[model samples]
Target chain A: MADHEIVIAGFGGQGLLFAGKVLAYAGLLEGRELSWLPSYGPEMRGGTANCNVILSDTPVGSPIVQHPNVLVVMNAPSLDKYEPLVAPGGKIFVDSTLVTRKVERTDVDVFYVPATQMAADRGMHDLANMVLLGTVLRETGCVGEETIDEALRHVIPARKAHLFDANKAAIEAGKGYVSAA
Target chain B: MKEKVLMKGNEAIAEAAILAGCRHYFGYPITPQTEVAAYMAKKMPKIGGTFLQAESEIAAINMVYGVASTGKPSMTSSSSPGISLKCEGISYLAGADLPALIVDVQRGGPGLGGIQPSQSDYFLATRGPGHGDFHVLVFAPASVQEMADLTGRALHLAWKYRMPAMLLADGTMGQMMEPVELPEEHEAFGTDNPWAAVGTGMKRPHNIINSLELSPERLEEKNVERFERYAEIEKNECAWEEYRMEDAEICIVSYGITARISRNAIVAARAEGIKVGMIRPITLWPFPAEPLLAAADKVDSFLCVELNMGQMKDDLELAIRCRKPVDLCYRVGGMIPTSDEVLDHIRALAEGGR
Candidate 1:
């Protein structure tokens, strides 16, 4: 099987790194080789945050993905920065509510999900990241949805356990958007 | 007892050290490596272990000296600049024939350079961490799992050889997350070595744990004994990994995070019909010279990749005895070389561009 190199980018508070962690956990739950590398610095809060997630059948090298096969941009800046870097035939998932600009790349499949607006509509304000993640999973089928559900249990700290249901709803809404598209 | 959990490399090192029976941890906070000290700080108190954030790196290493003298496993963690400050203490540990673990979660630097990931301290780690006729066993863990596994192994080696051992990692590994199968925890603060300074009483003579020897002859003897132990370690403890090397013409030599990058580069090179492979040195102190030399015999050329200005390139040349052309592809300070850049180098060498 071909390896999956994914780049998740957004503002720090958008749970970009947490989304990557959930994806990586899903891969691990399936007993696949995976790595998660986050852009770590003092500006981790309200700053540009990004992470690379590689899920492969073989050993992964260089957890820093330069030209990711899959890119999830949760904000305008993330979309502007990473859209061009996605591989020619790669897939990109954008949060359309915040990123009003259209994707310019015609070579790749682009899914414009209003992740934040949809999450807020469902009264799950903090799960925009999971909505985008669900859309990516639906498009790529990198890991099963059940695996992601199982992964959520691990990534969400016990103190935040109450958010699991809303997070799951956001993910389902995302998949629903993709199917509707 | 095989259970896997997602963990950061720095935290894994702390957990591994605890599992290896280490009870004393002394360290000052440094970026890229602070998690190590933090993990110990949180867990040690509950386990009845000692975790003291020393005033400085020098004090931390000396605390290691004091604990190691008791023959109980002790550790100290730091980054590049902090490790530099602990050099005097390291040399003292070496001269005193003490066993302890020192972890350098390396960051960019000659002096307070950057907190970003870097392997620029290769010379300090493998060549000379301190002044003197001495060497510390250096283990370069390429993954979070290895970060944990190697720390445990390093503690065992330090105790067995009565020498200081180092886990030479970088900021990337420390920060990255991966699934790791943790080892079972051992009883903390336990040591059976007869030389411990616990107490002599009527059973044996008092044990002296001092590095200072006034007489030249006595110091020379001590140095010779340490060198002999080093030779034995060289024979028995050199560790390395070979990937897709059976039919390759070019060999890429790397360690730690750079090795991880090379693995991807090699796969890309193979996809492009470039017959390239890699040899990752797991143990940097023993240097994996034998395996490197063996690879040198089969491969046409060798390319050494690192996050430094080509420190391991020299070791590659020395190991191969300058038999083949050994070239270098490197990034200095905190920048990481992309897989494409490394593959470009491999492609150039494959096409005889040299």
Candidate 2:
């Protein structure tokens, strides 16, 4: 809880950046200093995109996170691209559905969650990122569990706001994936 | 202070401007930057500020020019192509030495490029945004907070210098949401313009705010007098932030969204055991040359990463003196530079000594 830097990366369609934004928003609710920056461009059409979120007890110096205490890989290329650079002891939550390849780094704890399959099984196909969020919550407890669900509710645009229950179920299921592991 | 609000970049800039005591808002709707107008539309009426959505970007800026002539405080915003439309108006404002704030939440463009984040307008914004030996005080915000903060400062400086000020932001900085703490409404102190068109009380000579001068020597004198303000802006208004550069061997130069991306790159590069830091220019026009030039002397190599081919890098070479290699790595045509991509360039600088 001192100061956490986290990067959530996945394909452009995935809510990797949204998830990062929610974390930053939740941090704001906690009155913690924070910044969230997302990558943009045509690469978003098919390739990987990520968001950098930094939560600090002090005034956050640079909004750009250089080395993250946590890395959340929601797709294969995300893990493929960022795994090698994670700081020692930094944790990673890898989505098994998108990331078929096992992680090579053994220095840090790696949680393999089939968040996509779990969300699909739970009747919410697009809640994998939330599931990953839940896994992140269980592993680090960076933000309060109760606030996260509320953060998700408040952060999503109103048009998609009604998907709350399924998303909540997906996150709980995501935690279960890691808990059962 | 008003409540801490979760606001998009454009909304933040508009509300921030109001907090800075700006009473006139003129703009046309442009993608990414439209939220500025929407927010102003909703709040300006409530707060007794004037909000005018003009027929076009040209009309909007000229309206800004007219309001600025009254010398209270006024602003206009547009995207890249739309900003191009405002350049002529900006030139006139500069020539008249009028104090005004202009925000460009730049989208991709040479001509209606794309409705995505882009720093391609770096040249258009920094290198005399309009025409005829004119300059703008261009402030670039790396995060939404800086966007809010600089918007207020832009207003204050515009009034103080009697010059045009621009917030040179891009789409990512416009659409992204962040929490902002708005200052007290009346904290923004207003300036008095004795020459304002606002009722000369029928006592003083009628004030004429004009960019035109009939005599050749008179116009040249006017241009020279205006440049004296530009020199003051350079000396007094240049701002930037440097991170971990005390011993940085490899450095990256960036601004706005590219600045944020470079931060991630610096960290990723550090994990790869490379010593790297990012220097972000908060003011695009003044360009923050001193810090960059000092780093140029310190770091073995510098990489200027942007969403464009290499515009900001051109400035770094000019300002930083390029004692070491100042290379440019970029993506374009509505594409953004990734941290990994930037790290690739940083890594090259580390290993190959570029």
> What TM-score does each of the candidates earn?
0.96, 0.79
- The candidate that wins on TM-score is 1
Task: Name every residue pair that clashes in candidate 2.
Answer: A66-B267
DockQ of all candidate complexes: 0.72, 0.20
> Model 1: residues >4 Å from true position, as ranges?
A178-181, B186-190
For the second chain, the TM-scores of the candidates in order are 0.97, 0.96
**Candidate with best DockQ:** 1
Error of 1 at A106 (Å): 1.2
Which tens-of-lDDT digit does each residue in A65-110 have in candidate 1? 9899999887788888988889999998888888888889899988
CAPRI quality band, candidate 1: medium
What lDDT tens digits, residue by residue, belong to model 1 across residues B1-354? 586788899999999999988989999999999999999999999999999999999999999999999889999999999999999999999988899999999999888999899999999989758999899999999999999989999998998898899999999999999889998776433358887888887788899889999999998998998899999999999999999998989999999999999998998899989898888999999998988888888989999999998888898899999999988889888999999899989988988944
Clashes of 1: 0
Per-residue lDDT for B1-354 in model 2, tens only? 555766778888998899888879999988878889999999999988899989999999999999888887889999898999999999999888888999998887788788888888899888877778988889999878888999988888877888898999988788776678865565343566786888867788898999998899999888888778678878988888888787799878888888877887787788877889878888888888888888877788888888887988888998877577788988887677667788888887788874
